[model samples]
Target: MLPPILRLLATPLPLPLVQGMAQASLTHILREHPGLFDRLGTFAARPIAISPTDAPFDFTLVLARRSVRVTRRGATPPAYATRICGPIVLLLALAEGRLDGDAEFFGRHISIEGDMETALALRNAAESIPLDFVRDLAPPWRWAQRPGQAVLGAVRRSLLEREGVPCN
Candidate 1:
């Protein structure tokens, strides 16, 4: 569970800011890996909601259209074919292929609801790509890579520490 202070602070954030951040991040990922959603096969058209159980909002990914929509947790959400609910860190780890989805699922670290096929397709598709979000978000400059990755790594380590996960 996330700290109460974080939930409190995030709960009242402007919707546009949250949605815009999601869009920008999605744009970067798609730019870095074109045709990334094409590997979802028949599940590409299905909307998937990624809910960070410890967060104040959920992200509904419309992979078919290459966009994401953020919805406040307590508000009514649009229809989604599948929902993957977990801690934000675990979700990121899954997308980055740093964590085994099957093991986490079986270990009860994450929960999947709705269409199982869509979830499985997503897992397989994500696993096929090596996503380094830190590098992907950094400016495409040779000199920026190292410092950018270092800063991002430090931020991630702090977040992990806050979640009581040991940093290597």
Candidate 2:
């Protein structure tokens, strides 16, 4: 019931406004984390896209020297994109900066296609940060930040037993 309502509400939002906000957030994140661009420079020229299967969301990430924006459409076909095909909980766990990308991939929760190298770089950049990405979210989301870390810790422990040393 709530899902449909949420979608209906979100569907009416102006794309430009949403993109601007997303860009601002990404820019802020980059500014907060120095050396991130140096690592991401390889893929900065090429657009990065994130496609979430849960909704009609296709965010084409535009990363520049001083700005980043999540555009609604990609200017060109991407060699690779992060496919968020799992439950939204997976994303929450990731935002907390705990869930292992290799674990998620082997666990069949997420996938990156086309340019595997860039995807690897993206993962490295994301995990390099010391702070929880969820911290940047509104107050309402703070509770989940801690639990998300816990959930990822549990997954990490289990993965350690099944598969030694999961990637970040």
Candidate 3:
């Protein structure tokens, strides 16, 4: 049976509300880690976009004055330098070091565009962070991944069947 009506996040939440919460979370993490910014120092003023190939929204992270910030300008600046795109699950795994970056890249599951320096800086930062920060993200992600993909396929089939559309 379909789940009963429940909504954890109402639609049309104010953009600032989400951004502010994200900023706060990052700020809290930085306060705990204390040296992450130094790892990201190379891209201090530059914008680096993180895109999930399956997700509609993308955001850029910028470090300024030793603080990390997220922005959704949606406009790609030449200065934006590095952009990474991958399925949501794999991307999260990549950040968490649960999977090899090279395997994901060569498997064609992830793609990188633009400046190598910014990519390197981001890579180093992801590697330097204590696993506890990202370890929490992977288990739930890995657990739900297969079932989630199946559900998406089922949704597509159900919609197409209703529309008299044949999907081969």
Clashes of each: 0, 0, 0
Which RMSD values do the candidates have, in order?
Answer: 2.5, 7.5, 10.0
* lDDT of every model, 2 decimals: 0.84, 0.57, 0.59
lDDT of 1 by residue, 76-153 (tens): 878999999999888887887867888889989899999999999888888787677787777668988889889988
For candidate 2, the C-alpha RMSD (Å) to the true structure equals 7.5
What residue runs in model 3 are displaced by over 4 Å at the alpha carbon?
A: 1-13, 65-79, 133-168
**In model 1, which range of ten residues has the least summed lDDT?**
159-168
lDDT of 3: 0.59
Per-residue accuracy of model 2 over 1-168 as CA lDDT, tens digit each: 114554576666787777776677676676677666677766765556665544444565656545444433334433434333443345444544667778888987776666776667766767766644444432235667677666656644553344333334
TM-score of 2: 0.63
| Model 2 alpha-carbon miss at residue 168, Å | 18
TM-score of each: 0.86, 0.63, 0.61
The residue-level lDDT of candidate 2 at 79 comes to: 44
Query: Could you give the candidate ranking by lDDT, starting with the highest?
Result: 1, 3, 2
